[model samples]
Target: MIKTKTLFTKLFLSYSMIIFLSFTLFGLVFIYIFHLNLYDDYEELYDFHYERLQEQIAQSAEEGWSDEETADLIQPSLHHRNYNIFIYDNTGELFIQPEGDAEYEPDQEIILTASDEFVSEGATMNGNLSYIIADSFSVPGNEETYVAVMVFHDLNHQYQQMALMVLIPFIITIAFSGGIIYFISQKITAPLRHMNEAALQLATGDFSRRVTVSSRDEIGQLGDTFNYMAEELNSLEKMRKEFIANVSHDLRSPLTSMKGFIVALLDGTIPENKRDHYYLLMKEETERVIQLVNDTLDMSRLEAGQIEIAPAPYNLTRQLQRIAVLLEPQLERKGVGIQLEPEDTDLFVVADKDRIEQALVNLLHNALQFSLNGETIRIQLETTGDMLAVHVQDEGKGIPEAQLKHIWERFYKGEKSRTGKGGTGIGLSIVKSIMELHKTEITVKSKLGQGTVFTFQLPLKK
Candidate 1:
């Protein structure tokens, strides 16, 4: 469909054709008027010459001149004009032809004749090479006689001059008009050409490609809009990839754990009395699935801007103490010591207490999972400037460099860090999302063989 006539081509053809036809019509009208005016001027000049010859004929006749004498009078006048003049009697008989006006020599009997009704006005003859203007009057000396006065003006030279004047300008006008059309067409089509190329790139899945727009015109605005659409599609594609990876990992871990325990029981690896232990393991896998579903629901709510945060002044120290006490049983079972260090005063921040407590629990749980037995997990609360920060430091085999950045991503657990019964892997992602909704930030600092520290900061109350 795009291969058919496009907008630019249609507009170009429409405008160019309009210009061409308009200039052509103007040129033709101008030349036609010029030719008509020149012909009218030539007629006026011929009338003047005819009137002068009539006066000369009347004067010679009043002088009682003979035919030869009248011929002498007319010859000089006709010579000055380079015109052919003649006179005819009333009868259709031979009359006098002016000297040098006949085909024969001057001494020859040049018998010029005319009909009784004399010809007048101008007439073109001899293929329009000559124009004859004739006027007739009664001779004053002989009342019974009428004579014809005629002038023949050669028009070949005038015709050639007019043709050149009209033809040369027309040729020049056409050449100039064609050059203007070509230059303007190129200027208009250049930007459209670039837009065409950008569209092709988009079709081929190059969402990163964008058209460069330099003006605020319609075409430029179109380029900007296209670029914006490309950027949006690129962002959506990245989100799709992240979601797929997270979902795949989330589903695989629990299935693997459930399968292993079920197979052990079926193969009688455990005695009948110990079969209850396998059931507990299967129950744990079911709980991981439940936790994963709940975390996904919370994430959806946060992203859709539907989760309302209930903010109030909360004792930051009390929440920290509560988390340490709740996780003490698990910490002691792993032989990991829990320590809570407080500031000079009870640090307070404006936040939802329940949500903050949940986030702290997730952090402490993550720390305890990686810590070895006999290692210490330190929990600290401090105020710096206008913010209260909580730090959970675990002296365990710390997160490796490759896995540090991905800890907060959903269902992301390094191969070596995956314990058979540890977590749903969405705990840290939920914590990160909750902190973001509260306008707080969380960060991690860790090194291989050292310990890992996860810290979160919130706005301190006045």
Candidate 2:
């Protein structure tokens, strides 16, 4: 619901309101000024007509025209202009009608009559123009017989036009103002839209997307800041993954040797027949401790980028055979058979011989741990184009689906499958790291209660 009020809508509304109000105010002012000008024209026309009529009447007196003759000239002027002219005697009685009705009572007439103090009354008559202002002036020579002149100015039609002019522009300006506001808001908020999209992508874990930096404005600066944050997060994530991998591998080696030696010693391999048996047991424990220390140091060096891999062409088949020999005792104790699958014995891969052998040894030992007696742990080698894949497969209870992904994670164990099983949970992690260093790939395939296979592939020398 909140998202509905988008930037566009807000911008449009805000700007539209401002424009609408400004236009409305301007329109009202224009209409006021226009109406005032229109009224001024009417006032000047009325005054001119009144003064001209007085001149004509004075001229008629000089030319010996009667009041009736002067009234004839004024009568025509008032005919089409919606006005009435009249003359009143000293007693304010009707003397002549310029255009039409002259029998109006003094109270019913809108007379602009003047004696010493000019007086005028406004009246609304049904057959007339509904409003009247009369001007009166005394006939110069016949002061006793003063002349009263009445004029009517129709205000209704003028007022109606003024109102229409005011209302029309007001409506049009409001609409135009609203449209302008919308356009301006969209222009101003364009950068924010880009920033919003970038933020959404970042929330979804896409740190690769960067906000668009289009201007030197504040919104552009915000975009730059967001992009910088994404860069930092990407770097941090990389470091975190490296740390987990290093910690996992560093813990696997010694734990494997320790469990192996402890099992052997407990199985009476070191005799209870001699005190030297205790010394041998102590030596085995010391070796386990030493192996653990070395693995930790190696992992630290690798993560620190201080270690270099010296890749060379090495016989991968021979390497697997050596690991099988190394773990032969452990395999026998676990009652598992070790078998080397038939392949090109001279098959070679490009890698650091020592590192590859160590990796192969870890893989073999890991497979042997889960295998029972008479179950074959097969070591197979395959070549695809320029890659050499060595697979360590165990016929022991297969890895659970839920544990496959977590198997390479440090200190992670399948909740149900890990109980009572002795493992440092770091062997596969080391296998992963070593393969990464070699630019190799490792994969696993297993079904519950069926069997498990771990495959590590290294690039082969062409």
Candidate 2: clashing pairs of residues: 112-134, 112-135, 112-136, 335-373
Model 2: which ten-residue window has the lowest total lDDT? Answer: 104-113
Give lDDT tens digits, candidate 1, residues 1-462. 533276555655666677667766876786678656755665565567556656766787778778788777666655435355555665634366656556411111122322334343344454555544444555455564544444445566666776676668767776776677657666666667887787788788777777778778886787788788878666555545655666656667778888888898889887999888879878867876776677778767766778778989978887777777877767778998888886336788999888888788878888888888888888887778998778889887777787888777655545236344434456788898889979888999987788889988888989
Q: Count clashing residue pairs per candidate.
A: 0, 4
Candidate 1 off by > 4 Å = 1-284, 343-345, 396-426
As a whole number from 0 to 100, the lDDT of residue 406 in candidate 2 is: 73
TM-score on alpha carbons, each prediction = 0.49, 0.48
Instruction: Report the C-alpha displacement of residue 206, candidate 2, in angstroms.
Output: 1.8
lDDT of 2 by residue, 1-462 (tens): 545489777767666677777777777788778766755664566577667766766677678887667667666765445555556656767666654554333443334235344444455555433333355664466444445555554555656777787778778777676667767777788878887887888889887888768778787788788889999777656645654664455456545666666776788775666647555665755666676666656665766778778999988787777777877767777788888876446887889998877677777767776777788988888888888777888876887787788777654444227334644455677778888888878999997676888887888888
